[model samples]
Target: MPYINIKITREGVTAEQKARLIAGATQLLVDVLGKNPATTVVVIDEVDTDNWGIAGEQVTRRRERGR
Candidate 1:
């Protein structure tokens, strides 16, 4: 079994998009490593922008700067 964890900012991500992500990740593992899709596990975690940081700046602040 393969476990894939994906983390992203808590932006407005649609359910369809998340479904696509899960399917795509499972397919990638199947194609690349011959893993069984039935046994693969994919988990997505959505974090607050304030909790995610880059280059010492919070993602929330970074987006604020861009706006």
Candidate 2:
């Protein structure tokens, strides 16, 4: 089994983004990694803003408020 794991920021995450991510990942696995797209598995994880930070600043609270 070919497993693909993806992690993205909580901001601006959408279904179309997820689909495009999956498609691009699948293509990379097939074309570059030489994996079979048929047997490949893709997993996308939307990480909480607080769970990540930039410039040592937390954005979890901001993300929750926006939601």
Candidate 3:
């Protein structure tokens, strides 16, 4: 079994895109490692901009600055 965790900023990701991500991740494991799709686990975590930070600033502020 393979466990994969994917984290992304919750800005404008659509359900279709997320579905593609899950499917693609599962297929990657199946194609590259011969893992069973049924046994593969993929979890997507969306973090709020306020909760995510980088370069000593929150993601919300960074986006506001447009840098």
Candidate 4:
């Protein structure tokens, strides 16, 4: 079994997009590592922009600054 964890900012991601991400991640494991799709697990975590940071700045602040 292969487990994949995906984390992203909670920025209006649609269910269809999340489904595509899951499928793509599952396919990647199947293609590269020959993992069984039935056994592969993909988890996505959406965090608030205020909780996500880069360059010592919160993502919310960066977006506000247009950076």
Per lDDT, the best of the predicted structures is: 4
Q: What tens-digit string does per-residue lDDT give for candidate 4 at 1-67?
A: 9999999999999999999999999999999989999999999999999999999989999999887
lDDT of 4: 0.97
Q: Single out the weakest 10-residue window by summed lDDT for candidate 4.
A: 58-67
Model 1 per-residue lDDT tens digits across residues 1-67: 8999999999999999999999999999999999999999999999999999989989999998893
Name the top TM-score candidate.
4
Candidate 3 local lDDT, 1-37, one digit each (tens): 8999999989999999999999999999999999999
Q: What is the TM-score of each candidate against the true structure?
A: 0.96, 0.73, 0.91, 0.97
Report the Cα RMSD per candidate: 1.0, 3.8, 0.9, 0.5
For candidate 1, the TM-score is 0.96
For candidate 1, the C-alpha RMSD (Å) to the true structure equals 1.0
Clashing pairs in 3: none
Worst 10 residues of 2 by lDDT: 58-67
For model 1, state the Cα shift of residue 53 in Å: 0.5
Question: Model 2 residue 28 lDDT?
Answer: 90
Which scores better on TM-score, 3 or 4? 4
Question: Which regions of candidate 1 deviate over 4 angstroms?
Answer: none
RMSD of 4: 0.5
User: What TM-score would candidate 4 get against the native?
Assistant: 0.97
**Clashing pairs in model 1, backbone N/Cα/C closer than 3 A:** none
